[model samples]
Target chain A: MSAPLHDLTLAEASAAIARRRLSPVEYLDALRARFEALEPRLNTTILPLWEAARAEAQKAARRIARSGPRSPLDGLPVGLKDIIDLAGHPTTCHSRHLLGNVKAADAAVVARLRAAGAVFPAKLATHEFAIGGPAFDLPFPPARNPWNTAHHPGGSSSGSGSAVAAGILPAALGTDTGGSVRHPASHCGIVGMKATYGLVSRRGVFPLAFTLDHVGPLTRDVASNALLLGAMAGHDPQDPGSVVRRAENYRRHLRKGLKGLSIGFVRHFHETDQPATEEVAAALEAAARLMAREGAKVKPVTLPSLTDFAAVNRVILTSEAASIHGRWLREAPEGYSALTRKRLLPGLFVRAEDYVQAQRRRRELVAAVEAAFAGVDLLLTASSMDPACRIDDAEAVEATYSRQARTPFNVTGHPALTLMCGLSKAEGLPLSLQLVGRYFDEATIYRAAAAYERAAPWAALRPAL
Target chain B: MNEDEAAARAPGLGEAWRARAEEVAEAAAQARMMAQGFRAPADETAEPMPAFAVPAPARAVR
Candidate 1:
C-alpha cells in the first residue's frame, strides 16, 4: 500500500480487492481523482462513465463481501477504445461521422468483461475508425503521450495507451489491425498484446479490416496484460473470426523462466528491412542478450522484407476499410478529418487484382513466418523503429509512423506483445521490443516477456507525468 | 466504387477533397505498383487466403 492507489497494476489491485484490504469504491475514487487531475492534459477519455462506474464499484464490493469475487477483473476498471460498442453509449470512433452512433448491445469482448465483473470507467480516444493518424481536425483531440505530453502517443489505440501509461487506469482495451494496440504500447512504455487473429472476438468492435482486425489489451506491465487477455479471450460463435479454442490461464506461465526456450531474433526486421534508430536498435540488442543470459537460446532469424509485409497489410487494410467507408466517402467526404479522408481514400484506387494479390502474398508471408518458427519458440523484434515523435509534428509523425515491425504480424496473424525494453537516453522516451509467439501461444509470449521484464530495469521506470 | 466513379464525384466535393483524392491516387498508384511488382514464390494457380463456405440450411420450426 506504499504506492498510490492509481499506481497499482491490475493484478495488484485484484489481489488487494480479494484480500479485502482495498475497497473497490476507494480504488475507483482514487482513479477518478487521478482522471480529474490528468484528463485535461491527456485527453484520453471521450466519455467518462463516472456515475455508472461508482455504482458498479459498490456492487462489486458488496458482491465480494457477500460471497467471493467473480473473477480477478471483478472490481478492476478497464477502459474501452471508443470504437468498441457499450450498450447505450456512442462508439464515436473520434470522427464527426458517427457522433450519434449509440448501439443497444455490448461488443462481444465488452459482454465478456461485464460477465467477469469488470468495471468500465470511460470510452478512450482513438484515431478515426482506427486507421487515421493523429489529427487536430477530429471531433475529439488526439491523446497525448504521458511520457512527454509534447510527443505522440502511438495510435489508433492512442487513449488506451495514454491512460494506462499515465496510471489513470490499470488496463484498457485497444483494437489492432495494423499495429494500433502495439504502437501505443510501444510509445507509452506499457505492455500491449495482439493475440493471434481470431483469438479475441471482434464482434461489436468497429472494423478497420475484416480479415486483419484484432482486439487486444493494454496494461502497464506484462503480467497484467496477460491477466487482462485471459478475461478477454474466448470463442464467440457469432463472431466468424473467433477461434474455437478453450480459454487459458494466461498468467499461469508467467513464472516459468526462459531456460528451455529458443528465441529467434529477427534482426533483419529492425536493421536491414526498416532500419530502427540507434537507441531502439541498442535496446533490442540488450533485450536479446538479456534473454540469452536468462537461458533463452537467442539466434538470428530471417523472414520476408518489412516492405512486403507492410504493402500486403496496407493493401488489404485500405481495400477493406474503403469498402466499409465507401458510402460515407461518397456521401459525406467532408465529414472525415483531412488525414482520415486521405488515409481511407487510397483504398478506393486499390484494384481488385491488387487486393487479391495482396491476400495471396499474405498467405505466403504467413507461411514464411510459420516456417521461421520451426526452430524457435518465439520471435523477437522491434515494435516501433524509433521512440515516439512529437504529436504536433506532422512531418515527424509521418516519417516515423510506418517505421515499425508490427504490421508483419497483423498480416501473419501471429501473437505479438510489445513492452518497454529501455529508455532513449537522449529523449527520455521509452524504447520497446516485441515478442511474437506462434498462433494461440500467448502464454509463452507472456512467459518470455515476464522473464525479460524481471531482468530489465524498464518495468520500474514510469513516466513522470 | 471504381476509380472512374470516384474521380467523377471527387472534384465537386471541394478543393481539399480533390487534393486529398489526388494524394490518395498517387499513393495508391505506388502501392499498386509495389504489390504487383513483388513476385510471390507461389505459382499463378495459388488461391487467395479467404475461404468461402456454403451456409447450412435453416431448420424448420415445429
Candidate 2:
C-alpha cells in the first residue's frame, strides 16, 4: 500500500486519512517526496505553500484526533491555478507583471477552500494571463502534458491539468473563460466543469473578460470536482455578476443514468465546422450510442454555425478584454507576452456599433438557444477539434482553438462540461465529448455526463507517462 | 474617445462587455435596420470585422 501511495488520488487518500487509516503527516510527506520528484520532470507547480501546507495538515490531524467534526476537505491538499490569489503568495499569473505582487488576501475561492480545511500545496502554472497562452516567455515554463510530457496539456488551465493528472494534487482551481478548464481536462483526461456564468464568483481573479471568465475546477472525477466546487460555490455580494443559486451538492445525481433523458448531438460542429480527427469522432459517437442504449433519446440537433459563436465570443471577449487591459496595454504593453499583446491588439479595432450590435445579437442568440433547449435536456459536441496537440505547437490557445466547440455556449452563457470519452486507439491520446445544458441546468448535464462516464470504459484508462 | 467618455457610455450590463457590448448590441440594431438578417452571433465564425472600431478605454478622471 505504501509502494505507490504517491500515485493514489486525493479522493482515494482521503478515506484512509479520515478513518485514521493513514497519518496526514505521512501522506503529506509522501506527497512532498513525489512532488519533488515529479516537479523536475513535470514543471507544473510554482510557489508551493509547503510550510503553510504542513502547518494546515498538522492542524487537521489535531482536529481529527481531538474531535470528529471534519470539513469535507479536512486533510486534503489541493493545487490552485496561479491566477487565483493566495495571500502572501505571489498571484503571478505566470507573467512578470505580477512577479513580486504578493497578494495581501486570498481570492474568495482560495479563502473558501482553506475555510473548508484543505491544504494549499502550491499555486500551479497557467498560460500567461489566462486568455492567450502556453507562452514560455513569462516567468515559468508552460506545464507539460503528463500523458506525454512532450505533448500538449491544454491551457490556460495547463498546470492544473498536469498537476492533477500527474497525481500531484487531488483537484485544482482553474478558470475557464473560453475552453480553458474543459479543454485541459479533456486533453489530460480529467473531469472539468464551467458552471453557469455567474454560478461562481470571479472576484479577486485577474480579469480576462469579466463577463465570460469563470473560476471552476479540474478534477480526476466528478466526485472530487463536486467537493471542490461545493466549497467554492456561493454568492459573493462583492461580485456584481454572481447569481444567487443555492449551493448544490454537485455529486447528487452521479449514480443516476440517462433514463428518460433527451441528449442531442451537434455533429456538424464536430465533423465540419471544426472537423475532429477520426478517433475523436468515433469516441463521441460511441458515447452517444451507449447513452441511447441506456434509454436516452439521443438525436442530432442544430444551432447556428460554429462561426457565429466564434465571432460573437471574439467580439465580446476581445472588446471586454481590451477594456480590462487597456490601461495595462497602454502603459505596460511590453509587460505582456507577444501572444497576449497580439491577440488583444485586435480588440482595439472593434467599433461601438459593432459592440452594441453584438450585444443585441447576444440577446437574440440566447433566445435562439433557449428555444433549442426546449426540445432537449442537453446538447453535445466535441470538446476540441483534436486530441492533445504538441504543447509546443503554438503559444496562443487560439491557434487551433476552433470556433466550433465551446464558443457557442460562451455566447449563450450556459453551463458546459467536458469528459474524456475514450482513448484514441490509434494514438493512445484521449478524446472527449462536450455537454451543454440549459442555462443553470448543470445538474441534468452532470447526470447525463456521469451516466456516460460510468457506462463507458474510458474513465478507467490513465494516460501512459 | 474612450467608451466612458463617448456616446456609448453604457447604462446597462455596466462594465461588463463595454465596447463589444455596444458593438454587438448595435450590430443587432443595425442589422435590424438594413434588413440583413442580423441574428445574434451565436455559434458561427464572425463575418470579418467591419473595418471600424470601439473607442479606447477612458482616460483617468483627474
lDDT of 2 by residue, B1-62 (tens): 55433423322222433434444345334333322224544544544332111112111111
Error of 1 at A460 (Å): 0.8
lDDT per residue as tens, model 1, A397-449: 87665699999988888889999998888889999999998878888899999
Q: Model 2 over residues A217-313: C-alpha lDDT tens digits?
A: 8888766776677778887878877777678776787677788888778898888877778888888888889989988998889877776666666
RMSD of each: 5.1, 8.8
For model 1 chain A, where is the 10-residue window of minimal lDDT?
A: A341-350
Per-chain TM-score of chain A in candidate 1 equals 0.99
Candidate 1 lDDT: 0.87
Question: Chain A only: TM-score of every candidate?
Answer: 0.99, 0.95
**lDDT values, one for every candidate:** 0.87, 0.74
Interface RMSD values for the candidates, listed in order? Answer: 9.7, 17.6
